[model samples]
Target chain A: MGSNNSLAVRCRSLVKSYGSGDAKVTALRGVDLDVREGELLMVVGPSGCGKTTLISIIGAILSQDSGECIVLGHDLQRMNETERATLRGGQIGFVFQMFNLLPSLSAVENVAIPLLINGTPQKMAESRAREAIEAVGLGSRPNVLPSELSGGQQQRVAIARALVHDPKLIVCDEPTSNLDHDTGVAVMDVLRGAGKKHDRALIVVTHDPRIFQFADRIAHMDDGKIIEVTNGASAL
Target chain B: MLRVAVKMLMGDRAKYAGLVFGIAFTSFLVTFAASYFTGFMTRGFALISENPTVDVWVMDPAVRSVEKTTNMAASALDRVRSIEGVRSAVPMALGTAEVRFANGQFQSFQVIGVDDATLAGVPPPKDGVVPAALRTPDSVIADPGGTSGKLQTPLRPADQWPGGGPRLDVPTRSLTVGDELLVNDHHVTVVGKSEALPRFPPRPLLYTTYSNASRILLPERRRMTFVLVSAAPGVAASDLAALIEARTGLRARTSDDFKADTVSWFLENSEDVGDIAAMLTLAMSVGFGVTGIMLYMFTTENLRQYAVFKAMGASSRMLLAMIFVQVALSALLGTGLGLGLCAIASQFAVEAEYPFRMMWFTPLVSSVMVVIVSVVAAAISARPVLTLDPAIVFTGR
Candidate 1:
């Protein structure tokens, strides 16, 4: 972890809920957390425990109903949709559980999306995307479509996509949930190796306890609130 | 992003093909219907089209179209000739007559009588035969359209027929020069064939001199149907037409105006026009319905990918543009394919002499309709995508 003064995310009593009236359900309940820069923070919980909701608010894709949730020093509540979108496109990145690579695009093209979103020229974006794919050990098959790649390879491409723009924060939701044990660890090795930069913070939401050793810090949750925060392999 | 959008659209080959097929089918049917309608309107004024030399036609005030005319008096020609813009005016007698073929079969024909002096309203003869050939005693010119079917006569005499009687199985041939027929019991000879334009409701036609026509048909008090006029130098055809109408109290119209009037009359009075219009409406409706549904389904199926894009920080405007680009591509490709098919079909239609004409505006109109379809499809498909919450990407929903 980085110095105590260098905080990448700071949340104080954050609350979030879904639906209205009788159908209403709270997903996050007054959660307080701090993530330092250059840290791999793994959020572990049972199903419907609000692990996804906490990260969603931190990722700037969802808003908290109350309290402060600051990501990279900008209060998400104070930002409008366009400003939040700009922040997400420029400073933050996402990795989905499904390895949501656009099935039609080649591996390199999928990795190029973030840079393209930031208005990078096509040639420059694609060249940088090829380097990113190469870092993820997919340089030889950059032109292969996601459908033609193995599950682990596809997830590596997804990781490459998340890191292509060199965003300050990367939020991954169940990044290895669909892979076998060996492939899951391999994908995590690639993700951790490529994602942990000096200026970047990675928050991974996962149900898998097998990869707990890979985290620098682990936050355990039950229901809608975090119960405990433990250091790295000590959580095991 | 545009490249990504295109790849996403064409990635689903089946849906893309379906979308194209739907649009293409609509374009083809709509274009074909409009072209057929145009061809019919053109043929409605076939007579006015054939007499390109005549600038105006003066007929009875009640005459609304060339196809249905009320005969004018003989003095109508002289009255039109005396008009200020008139250069020359001649009488034309038009009537339906029953003609008995040499095979003893009788068929109805639209007989046209041109002025004996100038043969003013006669179409040029085919096979290099001159208009003066009609000056032969009892001579008339046949239309090529008529000789092919309605004016055909048996190749041999009745004795050569099976069972010693006129047989349907016997070979029949088209009427050529020197063929004789009985018109109202008077003998007439086919002097030559004329390259006449095909009529709307096709009828066999014969062109004869006014004197010869008068001799063959039963005498009527008003034998002149129309007065064909030429505009004098420095005079416009429209000016001559208006002047003739004012002085003679007749319906005097420039050839182009007469064609427009004929088309307007058909539009107002013809059931065929209504039928074609209904078919065109049905085709457009089917196109809208099918293409819209297919596009919506395709968008819905790929919505997950869109959600991912949104999660990746693509704005609503960007997603909307992507959908429009997909639909526009489909519209362009489908419209091209449809029009190409129509063009090929039109060739066969022309060869078979079907009422089909693809004017310059036909394909343009079809393309415009396709654009409208594409826009509608895009708008409908974009609704859900624009409203989607990017947070769904985390929910695994």
Candidate 2:
């Protein structure tokens, strides 16, 4: 497969495993996937079904054992550690299930981290972070620590952090698994609205089914492989 | 990112204080031990330091230090004075004398006898008293160290008993001009007080003429302990000393060489040096242990946060830099605080006449030790963070 302008990520027959000898466990076995620009792609599976592994490779944080995994016109296998870190810092943003905001920092400071990582000036990064937080309805309390924020508010801060750097690709893992039903839906609304842009792709890996309607397309995984791909309500 | 690292470290106030306290304690103890050792070594050569004008000291070959001397025959002074580079030579007698206060209190003192003609080795008296004061018959200059302590007598005759006997409740005062004392049964009068450097083993000092010393101290055939010499205007002290040693078959050393020999003897024979070394080693080890363990605990507690940073595109180098900055700040702050505490304590030590002197290189040495401690701490703490897998951020707990 050749690179495609429309596709933000393209993977073919990717394989990854952990450990060695009798204790070895394969995490991804010849997995093929495509995430298109301007689309919200959700990989859903039961626990230990390689949803994290697939998104980790696409996020440029983990290397595949074999096969082709290209992210944003760059082949993952050919990039060195520094190049991969530059790719992740400059082009990709991540949101996690734990809403992993550095607890020592205020909400705005946490949101400004990705931009700071990308070498943006501190004043400009914080200004953009404040704007992103405002867009997510967290403008009133940008100076509070993460521990002081509610689960829903912290998730909104995580979304603001992902969008503040204006990265071309955003990877989210179990973004709503730690929130309640209504809060999870509200967080999804904020994430999908602010995160997905005309030239960007958002990949969310979730076991939570409550936010299924937010995905433009959902890929179901089982035993280290993508078993099926289906369009969600947004796509229809 | 540097701000973030600082905030993370300062966020936990208790751990930050603990780390700083460990380093500060180490610095204070190490500095204190080193300064005390330096003070003792300085005092080890107090007699040499007192006579700065003397270029060379000629003594018997068996004399290693001024504190442990072997006296020479009276002819040794003539032998040294006849050398080509010798400008002047004076006899110096060092001996212990038992002095009886007016109230009959007996105390031992180190008596130094200067030459009658030049008074070469006598420390200058306080209050502008001239060297000619030694010319008075049976007159000696009592050092402040002696007068302030062992030479104190009852202030008034009435304070003593009716028969001039000692009274336990009498108010006492240090001896001054016109005060008389009995030295080895000979009546001697204090004509002046000398400002003398403190000595190791802390003995009171009395300076008198060589004739008076011969009478006051135990009689011996060899009366001269050393021949103090001044080199000619164009002569180097070391060269003059070598020439004297070659011609006279006596040991001759420049003042500096004699001082070094004194310190070497102390280091080889004294337990004080060993004790100070052990204390210094203990302080450094404890500093390393406490700081290293505390830093490792701090890093271990924040491993997940580091993992989050790692997952958020932070390279291992960035994380390492953060740890280094944290440790550097702690080391600097702790060193400053420790030195400040030592400065305060040294004031009290001086007032109490304790051996304490902060040499120029002491702070520099302490800072280097603290840096080593901080580097080791940062390395120990960074190991876990550097090896952490960012993938752990995806896992729960």
Q: Model 1, range A1-236, lDDT digits (tens) per residue?
A: 64344889999998999999999999888899999887889999899989989998999988899989999989999999888888999889898998888888999999999888778999999999999999989899999999999999999999999999888888999988899989989988877776564457889999888788789899988888999999987977
True-vs-predicted CA distance for residue B97, candidate 1, Å: 3.2
Q: Per-residue lDDT for B1-397 in model 2, tens only?
A: 8878888888888988987888888778778778888888888898999899999999999999988887999999888888998999999999998887777777888999999998887887988898789999999999855134666877987763236565645778988888888898998999998878888867888899999999899889998999999999999999999999999999999999999999898888778777766776776687667767777787888998898887778888889998998888888888888888888988998887777889999988987888887888789889999888788788632
The lowest-lDDT stretch of 10 consecutive residues in candidate 2 chain B is: B160-169
Number of the predicted model whose DockQ against the real structure is largest: 1
In model 1, how large is the Cα lDDT of residue A193? 76
Clashing pairs in 1: none
Error of 1 at B41 (Å): 2.1
Prediction 1 global C-alpha lDDT: 0.86
**Best prediction by TM-score:** 1
Error of 1 at A68 (Å): 3.5
Of candidate 1 chain B, the 10-residue stretch with the lowest lDDT total is: B159-168
